[model samples]
Target: MVNENREVTEKIINELLHGKICTDASAFSELHRIATWTNPYVDYAYVDDYSKKTIAIIFFDKYNDNEIIKENTVKAISEFDMVVDAYDVHSLNEANFYLQDITRTRLNALPISVIVYDSNGKVSPLNTISISEHKATKRTVKEQRSYWCWWRDGSHFEVATLLELSQKYDDEQGDIYTNFVYPEFFNLMIEGKTRKWDGTPRVKKYSTSSYKSEKQNYKIPMCQLGLWDVETGHITHKGESVLCVIKRYGADSKEFFDYLAKIILIDGKHLDLIKDLEEFQKNNTELIPESSSEFFILFDDYMTQKNSIGTRKPTAQKTGAKKAYVRDEPKLWNKLGIVKLQGKSRYYKSYVGIEFDWDRINEILLADIFGGSNEKI
Candidate 1:
């Protein structure tokens, strides 16, 4: 019986390698034969194109007992770039176990990681799932795919297989965007020229203030703030999102700019500016030199007062002066074309501006500095 079982297993393995049992039904038949070994010489069997070059055969029986046959087989197959577990069964009774596992896993599709930047300049991670797919084409052979994100209605969502969701994102032709309307509505879509459809992202804005009022808001991790959506595999921000927040509140008052300062350090896109703030935060003793450039001087005062409240002297007056100076600085940078500052503001002061042109500063921002003209702010 054992000899017969070994012969059957070898034949099945050969057939798998030769692509004879590639379909789900044929693979199951082969696995069943190995599982029904009379002397328990075979444990399980499976076939897949895990090696990339061609189909690979994986099987186990009582003859191999030195290592975990199942675990080793899975690990080996997973190492390949593309693989599909065609069939696996440990015993005759467990013939349908593989199908059941697939069903269960699909019900809870992989958790997606979404990092959102709040108005307060902090980053928070929100896990969202691909809930459904919107058909982008009617053709039978080559259908286009699109996906709908699981709505963030403060409820747990069940996951399921939505292949089109992946295909639509993969087919993105231009820059994608993630826009949050104040507090509730959050949208993600590809930009106009590169977008395949004419769908507007302005969905109904949800009201979460009541919920927020009841719960304390926790700060998001600073590291996850950028535009990358790891779950969907896309680079999405298309406009001046948090920058608008800064422009509105940054220079409004000392209290507001202080908050904006923190936001910039925590979630700012400009790599150099973020580093400067982080350095200043680490070393509070370094005073802003009088001869330093204007931006540095203003930035130093901002950091010194923001981080070293109790330790620094003349807190009130210094803070006040720095606040007054910074309120008009964004306007100056705008007039000099240092940055494409979008909002409206006025600078009534009359003095000779700094001798150098401020264009170099535009290079540092969360957005791509030299992006195509079609790209958004």
Candidate 2:
């Protein structure tokens, strides 16, 4: 669908660069409500500067690839360093106060304010056509750099990091090698030598637990932890993400599950815990429900308990309780960590999970500790 406002904007920019141009203010004021089929939401505005120059503005759908529009719009205004502008879907119904500062104006209002600056003495449609061709060259001339941002998220650790990330599971340092993140921690496990964090080449060292109960736990590990990619701007798990270095190899479900669960519960509170729970079940298809009634009730109780903690001093302790139960014990059996609310003897919130030895994820090892490969840029 043709964005009439944007179309008018292009026309206006073309004219303003040519010379002084104006529009009928009364004609725009007549429309009641305006929108475009491409992406509904009449969020367009006009901006002006202290120098009395005016500009038309519009928002776009994130996926909207208005190649010509962006190129031409940038080209139309490029010569005028007097006015800086941008188009994005992020701002909606927000007025550009400088133009005439008042949001009462709707987006359907066309032929918006004047273009105040014009560096081009004889810019024409032909030049606007050239904008696309020259844009890449122009951008390269501008300063640029590449920074490797997030590649994985908490989800990645379920497979590797849980082995080493847990401060409480410090006793389980021996088991960290099996951590899901292990494979990717040192250069995607692609082609590099693992190094100690202190610039030293590294290798795994074995451990023997003094506690007999520890012997009953899973075998010790022999790998490293890694990172996952997050959204471009958001810094936390709330945004969309995926496994990065951890997935350089295949995946380990046990580690993946543990990492994912921690992230969901870490925030403590969000829009609705139940909503996240539902999503969890939908994503991890491995979980089997042993006790539905108890699980639901405890989940609600956990929600209440989670909220109650705010009134008290902050600490890892929650209402003086820990959740730990085996499936055959009782329907109302208690478990600890975030899954304390489960009804079954064994309470797992979702099918996906990391096989945490209930003790290892938090262990701190004083053994001749070794680091892995250095992260490359």
> In model 1, what is the error at residue 246, expressed in angstroms?
74
Off by over 4 Å in 1: 1-6, 17-19, 23-56, 63-70, 80-90, 106-377
lDDT score of residue 73 within candidate 1: 33
lDDT of 1 by residue, 1-377 (tens): 22223234345444443444332222222221111111111232222222212122233233232134334433433332112222222332232343344345552132111122222323222222231221111213121110101111111000000111222354554322121211111212111111111222323223466335212111111112332343332332411333333345442233333232222322232222333333553454344333324544455476444321112135535655443322333332333244433235322211222222223332222233233121111
- Indicate the residue-level lDDT of 174 in model 1: 35
Superposition error at 237 for model 1 (Å) = 51
On the 0 to 100 scale, the lDDT of residue 372 in model 2 is: 20
Q: lDDT (CA) for every model shown? A: 0.27, 0.27
Q: What RMSD does model 2 have?
A: 22.1
Which of the numbered candidates is closest to the native, going by highest TM-score?
Answer: 2
**Candidate 2 lDDT by residue in tens digits, 1-377:** 11232344444444544443432221121111111111111222222222223232332332243443334334434322112122322222221332233113331122223122122222121111111111121122121110101111122322233333332233443433234233234323223333322323434333343222222121111110111111111111221122432343333443334333333222111112223344445554454344454444444344333221111123313655234211211221121132343334344544332122323212211111123211100
